[model samples]
Target chain A: MFLWIIQRDLLLAMRRRADVLTTLFFFIIVVSLFPLGVGPEMNMLRTMAPGVVWVAALLASMLSLGRMFSSDHADGTLEQMLLSPQSLSLLVLGKALAHWLVTGVPLVLMAPVLGIQYDLSTDALLVLTASLLLGTPVLSLIGAIGAALTLGLRGGGVLVSLLVLPLYIPVLIFGAGAVEASAAGLGAGAHMSLLGAFLLASLVLAPWTAAVSLRISME
Target chain B: MAINWFKYSSPASFYSLAGKMIPFFSVAAAVLFVVGLYIGFFVAPTDFQQGEAYRIIFIHVPAAWLSMFLYVIMAMWSGIGLAFNTRLSSMVATAIAPTGAMFTFLALWTGALWGKPMWGTWWVWDARLTSELILLFLYIGFMSLQAAIDDPRRADKAGAMIALVGVVNVPIIYFSVKWWNTLHQGASVSLTQSPKMASTMLTGMLIMSLACWMYAIAVILIRTRAIILERERHTVWVGQLQEATQ
Candidate 1:
């Protein structure tokens, strides 16, 4: 059931490539704008890079949350899914993973290139990428709950951010902290472990919450 | 004889019960506020380090405690409402949000007032302050989420789910002072250990906190009564109550 949902969503996303590209471009543009805004000072940009990149990733992930269930909901597929005997949580988990695959993976892939623009050392750049690799999935997972709750509500896009962003703080702190720690010659292990922990915890928890939220919203 | 606890779970019965209790709590809160402030402003000795500015702890500590305390209570009511589909519990949860948010804003404001005098700045990115700010955001989010949904039942359940999810942060906020050695000071009063402050200061702060509790209960009960009428307006009991009032 999980793989089927992922495959189905991937195919749908592939058919409308612009939707996926838009989120990636948003991540890139937001990251690129920082250096321009802050001036081209290497020392400052290097320090600012981790936080800037992580925050952009957070926003970009949030922007795509609206797409998680709205289309299916509008077309009445969501009602069908809810009626299905299979657990709704599994279906939501698959959608969250696909969301990460489409939106989160690109940012993880792009962070290193952006890090270079900030003059981040090679080791810091690697840490930035590795941190995003673990961290962005958690964003998608937690965001799914927000998206599900605000499903079909007016002003849902803004509402989702208000509901979800505070919850995202620990992820933002540790995600950016990993890169900063690595830059300072401190091992990124502790921060990385915390991010991994967040990813694992959200993986277990968010889908179920989102599933319950879907039922509430749909009813 | 066993008490029928579920009797007041009905909105109609709870409405009158809440009305009867409000005056007692309101008077207690008023009296406690006077006593707590009297001791807080006059009787408590001036801190050697902070001088007279430290007296804001009387309000700050209570507001901060209630902000976190009410969130837990709100979530507990919300959780009960969700699991058992109880209407009164959900209404109580709704009523608690504004007061909780007020207390949160009070804590932040008083912390700022206290901070300006003691720390030489109005705010810092200390763990406790940041977490408290997040707590305010969580309260706002809960209220807004419920406001956006048109169906009251859907609003209740959805808000309840988010409330339960956000409950994890309360513990983090409570422990943030210990977890990171931030600029914010540790607890002056704790359950396990004796308080770290002078006895009079402790007494005044406790009384102030009790005042806050009474104030919160009085306010929440009144709000919940209003909510009951608004939500149950179509019912026969509400219609009869309106006629009786007229």
Candidate 2:
């Protein structure tokens, strides 16, 4: 049942290619704007690269969070999903997993291109990709709770960022730290492992909370 | 006889109870602050190394301590609201927000003041400072989330979930100094250790901390009363309470 739900979400998302492309485009544009704003000195860009990329990714992921559950809730599909024999927890987890695939994986894949603008080294690019792979799932999982909480509300966009950004601190710290470490020729394995532990913990915790929030908002 | 636990859980009863306790706590807090400040500022001996500049520790350490302490208390009240459907629990959580934010601001402000003298700079990207800044953002986020929503009940539930999630970040903030190779120093006073400083200094710091604790409780009680009244405005008790106050 979980697999079917995941597949269904992916198919639905694929049908809306413009939405996915637009989000990715926004991510790229925001990242590119940072170097232009901060000046194009290679050394300066290298120094600030990890933070700029991580923040842009955070904002882009947050922009995508509001759409995660809103359309379904609005169309009554979420109600039908809730009433289905499949546990709401699994449904929530499945949707979160699918959202991570669509939103997070693209960010991971696009890191190399963005890294080039920051003048990040090949090694730094690899570490940046690895950190994003581990970190963005955490973002999606945590973002799921925010989305569920604000599912039907007006100005949910602003409220979702306010609620979720604090929770993103650990991910931001470790993710940016990993890239910076690799850039400095230090081993980033420990930082990457911490990011993985954080991701695993959030994966286990966020869906249950998201399910509860969904039920409350639905009520 | 069975205690009618649910009776005081009512917003009206809790409002009156909070109102009654506020004056007592305020007086206690005032007394403690006067005595503590006398000991801390006037009588406490100067630091052997950092000199008189260490006087900021009296406020800095206590404010930092309370910032973390209040986040935990907020989470506890939020959990109670979620688990048992208690009427006053969310109000209690709501009441703690401003006080918690104030403590966080105090921590940062005094930290900067202390850092300027000690580190020779007003700011550094130390792990502890960064995490505390995040803590401030978390408190602001909770308050903003509650305010943005129109329906009080839905707002409470949403704020509760955010609070619960944000609680995970508090321990990270507390331990960031220990976890990373950072510029910030570790705790001078910890739960499992003997005092690292002189007995007099430790006494002064602890007393100031106690004063901060009492002040936090008093402020939260006063704020909780306001929350209960605002939330229960349509209720007869609120009308009567307003009439009495007027």
Candidate 3:
């Protein structure tokens, strides 16, 4: 059921490829703009790179969250899925994973390139990519709850940010912290471990919470 | 004597009960405020280090404690409302939010006041302050989510879900200092250890906390009564009560 939903969403996303690319472009542009805004000093840019990239990833992931279920909802497919005997949480999980695949993975792949733009050393770039790799799924997972809660509400785009951003702090802390720690010659292991913990815990918990939120929004 | 515990659980009953109870709590809160402040300012000895500026702890510590405490209580009320489909529980949760947010703002403001003289700055990105600011955001989110949904019941359930999800941050906020090395000091009044302050200072602080508690209850009960009236206005009893009052 999960794989089917992921495959189906992937095909749907393929049909509308611009939606995926928009998020990716937004991530790249936001990451690129930081060096310009904060002078092009290499050492300074290197120091700011991980945080800038991680924040852009957070925003890009959030920007695409509206598409997670609003399209299915508009077409009434969501209600049908809700009535399906298979667990709604599993379906929501699939949708969130699909979202991460569409939005999150691109940022993770693009981080090293963006990191190089900031003049991050090889090791720092690797840690930046690795941290986002471990962190962005948690963003997508937790964001599913916010997206579900604001599903049909007006001004939902702005409202979802207010609802979800505070919840994203721990991820932001540890995600950006991992790179900063690695750059400081502190092994990124502890921060990576914490990010991995967030991933595992959110994986177990967020789908069920988002599933309940979907039911609330739908009903 | 057999007592019916659920008697006041209904919005209708609780409305009148809260109305009667408000004055008592308000009075107690007023008295405590007077007494707590008296002791806080005049009785509690000045810190040898901080001198008079340390007195803000009476207000700051209590407000900070209440802000976090109210979030937990609000989430619990929300969880109960979601689980049992109880209107009153949800109303109480709704009513508690503004008070919680108020205390959060108070905590932050007083922390700034206290920090300027002590930390030599109005603010720092210390873990405790950051988490408290997030706590404020959580309150705003809960209230805004509820306000956005026109249907009270849907709003209740939706707010409950967010509240429960946000509850995970509370422990993180409480432990943020211990978890991270930051400018914020470790907890001075933890239950596991004897307080590391003068006895009079401790008394003043606890009394101020109790004053804040009484004030919060009075305000929340008053707000809950208003919420009850708003939600239950279509019912017969509320109309009759309205007629009686007029």
lDDT of 3 by residue, B55-95 (tens): 99999999999999999999999999999998999999999
What order do you get sorting by DockQ, best first? Answer: 1, 3, 2
How well does each candidate superpose onto the true structure, as a TM-score? 0.99, 0.95, 0.98
Candidate 1 chain B weakest lDDT stretch, 10 residues: B237-246
lDDT of 3 by residue, A1-219 (tens): 999999999999999999999999999999888877989898888888889999999999999999999999999999999999999999999999999999999999999998888888999989999999999999999999999999999888888999999999989999999999999999999999999999999999999999999999999
By DockQ, the best candidate is 1
The CAPRI-style docking tier of model 3 reads: high
Clashing pairs in 2: none
TM-score of chain B taken alone, every candidate: 0.98, 0.96, 0.97
Question: Weakest 10 consecutive residues, lDDT, candidate 1 chain A?
Answer: A178-187
lDDT of 2 by residue, B150-203 (tens): 888888888898889888778887888888879999989987998899887788
Residue-level lDDT for B72 in candidate 1: 100
lDDT of 2 at B22: 83
DockQ of each: 0.93, 0.71, 0.84
Of candidate 3 chain A, the 10-residue stretch with the lowest lDDT total is A34-43
lDDT of 2 by residue, A118-141 (tens): 888888888888899899999999
Worst 10 contiguous positions by lDDT, candidate 2 chain A: A178-187
Docking class of 2: medium
